[model samples]
Target: MRTSGVLPDAFTCSFLLKACVSLLDIANGKILHGVVEKLGFGSNLFLQNMILNLYGLCGEMADAMLLFDKMPQRDVVTWNTVITQMLKRGDIEGASRLFSRLEEESGLRPNQVTVVSVLAACADLCALDLGKRVHEYSNRSGFKNNVLVCNTLIDMYAKCGSLEEASRVFDEMEGKRTVFSWSAMIVGLAAHGRAQEALSLFSSMLQDGTEPNGVTFVGLLHACAHMGLVDEGRAFFTSMTRDYGITPGIEHYGCMVDLLSRAGLVKEAYEFIMEMPIKPNGIIWGALLGGCRLHKDIKLAEQAIQHLSVLDPLNDGYYIVLSNIYAEAGRWEDVTRVRKLMKARGVKKTSGWSKITLDDGIVHEFVAGDESHPQAEGIFRKWDELVVEMMLRGYVANTSLVLLDIEEEQKVKFIYRHSEKLAVSFGLLNTPAGTTIRIIKNLRVCEDCHSALKLIAAISGREIVVRDRNRFHCFKDGCCSCGDYW
Candidate 1:
């Protein structure tokens, strides 16, 4: 319109800015901001809100906030935009505070979009209490029936370690079920080690004449992987392409490798990777490497590292995993070589951390060997007691995972300082019996922690649900839901 000698108005600029946001065209977006100012629509609330949203979506939060502060008038959309962007950037506290202000200060009732965004924040933080409150409000306000809101509710519940509630929401939404609904519910069930139930739900979805999408197959494959149903996983992967004609993406390939590798078919996984129509990406190679680490397949792990070094040269995870395999195999020299390579390349390993959700609606984070919490001394004391109790129960600390060239006794002490154990110890100290302890890990759970957790469950008689870097493991009655396979 401007090129045609017609002066663009606020509406035109808003539409253009939205297009730029959708396209993530930061370069053009800045020029459009200038155009808005030149058109003298800087004070146009709608256009200004759109500009704020554009900056937010482009990850220019500082710019967005600067503009937000200068605006003389702010509407519900403006608040929603800023809050939603905050959540998208993983700023749960910021989003939650803004969400509270929406009703308390502005007296603006949150719409489905705002509620969905808040629910997402709650999910990421694993703030189940907050999520429950949001669910209650959605039901009271009749927004639970909204498709987007309902779908997000299921995801939030699942991600917060409440799979049953997610399933209830899905089962009750019979008429409102969409493809996204089925996909979300399936992934949730599959993640919780409910492979059979997830498959049953998939069958039910098909019976209801709902066609499967790529995401649906991803869920099915995931269920198979965790269940060690290699034949079933193979059949599903075949059907996904041969029956549904949906081309398998890297995610599907990664799942297939995980299924084969986790089941101890490391050689087959490598063969499958080589046969992939598309070049195997880092995920596929990493999946293979992870399998090698699980099964101690040094040869395949070395091969995986060869490809991974070329595919993801800067990723320290692959190198660390290879070192782990070497250590497990008792090849100390190889472990040293891998560590040397990592140091030479300046590849810093990602530090492991765990998060525990407290009953008082707070999430506490503990890094490996962390002593930052106010109750750190008490937590450590509890952990020490648990260690002694576990030792009396015939638990021997598996120090093979401690890669350092140190004394065996020191390695055992090092194992005790793992973040997950610290979090669980803190949970046991504070929480009442029979309450489940949920932990989120930033890296794959070490073998030592996995064995130690199994014993912890047996001794404490409390169920522990840990969503590790790889998959979810629920330990109870001296066993894990993955049956020692994962």
Candidate 2:
């Protein structure tokens, strides 16, 4: 068009910029911005909003904000665009603040899009109070049955530690349940250690004449894996292929491997992977590796690591786990080799972080060996006291999980002060008696912490639910929900 001397107007420039955003073509989007300026569409309000949205999608928040602030007239799109950008960047607090301004201070009514974004932010932060308020507002504002808004509410309530509320919204959604609706509720139930309920829900979905899709099977298989429902999961996998004609995708295969391996059927899990029609991906191998870790099967773990390293060579945790497997067996030479490989790959094992939601709506964060919190001194002091109590109650430290090749005493100390332990200790200190302590961890909870949590729950009479990298572990009365299998 430019070569034919047909210069683009504001409408044309905005259309192409939106295309660039959809295609994620930032390079050409900048070129289009230049064209918009040359055509003197720079000051055009509609074109300016498009430019702002382009920058937002590209994650150039500074530029997006500069353009946004300078605009003499702004509309709902401008606020929503910036708020969505904040969410994409994982700045949930920023998004919530902007969302408030969009509704209250800016005197603009939030549409369904804004509500969805806010609910998403609430979920990520595990801000249950705010999420409850958002749910109330959404219902009163007549978005209760809006599929996206309702689906997001399910996810928010689930992640914020309320599976019952999520289910309530699902039931009340009535005729508005979409595939996403089923997926959200199913996945939420699976993640929260309600595997049997999740599968029952799947049965209902099928009975309602809804076709099972890949996502649906992923949830079914995952629920089975969490509960060691091997036979059930196997049947679902077969049915997914034979009845629904949905060929087992990588994720579906991952769920199967996880299901089989978690049930101590390591040999069969390996065989299943070998017989896969498609080349197994990293996720598939990772599931098997996790199983190997639980069962302490070094041989199969080595096989999984070989394939996994090639696929995710830069993933430090896999190498660390391999080193750990060797370290557990006193295979010093092999452990040394794994460490050397990590150094060569420039892979550093990132420290784990644990987030605990307090009753007052504040989310507290803890990192391994982190001492930056204002209450760090008291938290650590309380941690030491708990350690003493647990030791007195015969809680032996499972120091095999401590990767460092250090003294025995040092290893035990390391396990005792893991971020999750500190988070749990802090929870006990701050919360009232009988209050359930829910903690979220960024990495897999180590075996030592798992054992300690069981004992801690027994001693303190507190029910603890920990959401780790793998799955939920509910500890009560000196036992874990996984029955020491996980």
Best by lDDT: 1
Which candidate number would show the highest TM-score if scored against the true structure?
Answer: 1
Candidate 2: residue pairs that collide: none
Per-residue lDDT of candidate 1, residues 1-486 (tens digit): 667898887778888888998899888988998898887888889888888888899899999989988887888789989987886675656666776777887777888876887788777766676678778878987886788988988988888778879989887899889989999999988887889989999999999999999999999999999889999999999999898999999999999999999999999999998899999999999999989988888888999999988989989999988887887778889889988899998898889999887766556889998988899999999988888988888888887678888999899878889999999999998899999898889887888899889989999999998988767788998898777767
What is candidate 1's CA lDDT for residue 262? 92
What TM-score goes with each of the models?
A: 0.89, 0.88
Superposing all C-alpha atoms, what RMSD in Å does each candidate have to the true structure? Answer: 3.2, 3.0
> What lDDT score goes with residue 6 in model 1?
89
Please report, in order, the local distance difference test score of every candidate based on alpha carbons. Answer: 0.86, 0.83
- Name the 10 consecutive residues with the lowest summed lDDT in model 1: 87-96
Pairs of colliding residues, candidate 1: none
